[model samples]
Target: MPPTLKKSDFHYDLPPELIAQAPLPERSASRLLVVPPAPAAFDDRGVRDLPALLQPGDLLVFNDTRVIPARLFGRKATGGRVEILIERLLGSHEAKAQLGVSKSPRPGTRVVLDAGGEFEVLGREGEFYLLRLLGEEPLEKLLLRAGRLPLPPYIQREAGADDAERYQTVYAKQVGAVAAPTAGLHFDEALLDALRARGVEFGHITLHVGAGTFQPVRAETVEEHRMHSEWLNVGAELVEQVRRTRARGGRVVAVGTTVVRALESAVRDGELQPFAGETRIFIFPGYRIRSIDALITNFHLPESTLLMLVSAFAGRERILAAYRHAVAQRYRFFSYGDAMLLFPGRES
Candidate 1:
């Protein structure tokens, strides 16, 4: 490993006002910063010009995990307002969630959700509270009608009618993610069609982003940080496609960090394989990547694990320089911000 990267190495100054409070009016209208393979080559483009930028044979991998309405507001039996954000489902009717209220609800305390459905707090599990549903319908179905869209905290607005549709990607199908793959949100049907016309193949893997994604790294040292494990699945068909793409010397372009983790975690002995389970791979500047060749991702928070992952993919210094350029160019930052097309760099 490249001499255990210090957490301080990723630090940068970001203006509070630059953090995107709202998504772009048009998804594809978001800016794109193209970080070339080397420092000598620099080209900046708009997200709409991606089709002309990528080669014909490149395989653009995407995360198809759908964002669920994990945020639910309800009233405690004692008349206090309570907000519940589901973290993950433990069983058919049991789920783990983060509760926000004036006072912590104890076990056996009942809270009435939307449409009069109720949930009883079972107990605490680590940082999350265990909940048991009291109705016959599945939690997924109930949440669809009753819960609100769990927009990122950086977006300083309440969930609106448009957020339910706008926050999600056009390709989102499997329902599990608490957060949308922001990079994929830029691609509309027209862009997909345009990419297909240019011979860019597309495939999907699922990585259900948990609410833990928003948790900031508490460790001062990079090695001291324990990355959160998120569930991922890469099927056999996708594996076969990847192998075929490799055989033809086509580049594998991952759409988001979630797709990168899903692909890399599924590779064994340098060969891609079908995989399903949790992965806590904490990528930093020293880690050698064995799967993805290119990355399409959004601007990330300074000193964040996501930023560390990108720095690991590209050179840390190069990524930092690119970030400086983005800041100077007035590009938006965070989950709903502008994107970068990165070419993986050699490990130092």
Candidate 2:
């Protein structure tokens, strides 16, 4: 393998028009760039072709963490506008988040919520602001009525009615993630049914993707970067399914990088065991994966950790070449863009 690449190695020139503003008219209608083992093996296909892309007995692991409407716009007691992006709920009434405003609101400042409720900025802990929701109604209920979908920065638009459905995966059930697992966004009911009909087994894990996912790395070297910790749960049932799939000589395909992290985080003593905890694993080049045999992910931002993770899964050279192909073909980039099905090697 080549030496660990600098962040600049993953950089590419993407046209502004290719950054997807809205999802494809249909969820499964988006393009799929197949990065085969060799240059001669490429195929540009639609997401509907997923059933034909894989063999029988492949275990598709999905992150079922639902994206909550975590973004909220409100006003302080002084009438200054502020936007709060919830990171995670620390308790029923307390949470941590990133506050965006012209000026940072100091502790004990009251901010009126969009739902007619209010909150107090209790204090700060590191980069997150501690917020205390002040209302008789529960925090989740308040957010359900007033919170905006925290779409990525690249997607320039106000969250509309369609965004509530389009930004989430068809199978998303556990509500925690601030960001959607973009790879799973392409899987509609019809495509999932087709895959299941073609004998693909599916499993579910949870990883509440935090707001830090959108934070860029400022460090020079890969080792200098501090990964954000996210909560993950790999239950006993999913562990057994993975073990059983491997026992039968089947491949375990992660639907997104979140699934890969959750699966790999669960492995203890060379075998995957059930787990429920926080993980700060930063996967870059030279990191050997233990659980995921293949990955399906969207094209990531230039010089971002997500790009590095994909480079680690496949070799850096292969992924860089694939990105060039994707950009040259005018593939949409970022969260709501097209996806790539990556097989690191022939053997699992």
Point to the candidate with the largest lDDT: 2
Q: Which pairs of residues collide in model 2?
A: none
lDDT of 1 by residue, 185-291 (tens): 89988889999999999999999998887888888888899888789999998998888888899989999999988988998888899999999988887777779
Model 2: CA > 4 A from native: 1-4, 38-40, 345-348
**Tens-digit lDDT track for model 2 on 1-348?**
546557677787888898999998888888998876654466789889989988789899999999999988899999999899999988778899999889988999999976688999999988899999987777888788888899998888888899999999999999899999999999998999999998899999999999888899888777789999999999999999998999898889999999988888898999999999999989887788878888999999888989888877877778888888888899988888999998783221
Looking at candidate 2, what is the lDDT of residue 5?
56
lDDT of each: 0.88, 0.88
TM-score for each predicted model, relative to the true structure: 0.96, 0.96
Off by over 4 Å in 1: none
Minimal lDDT window, size 10, model 1: 35-44
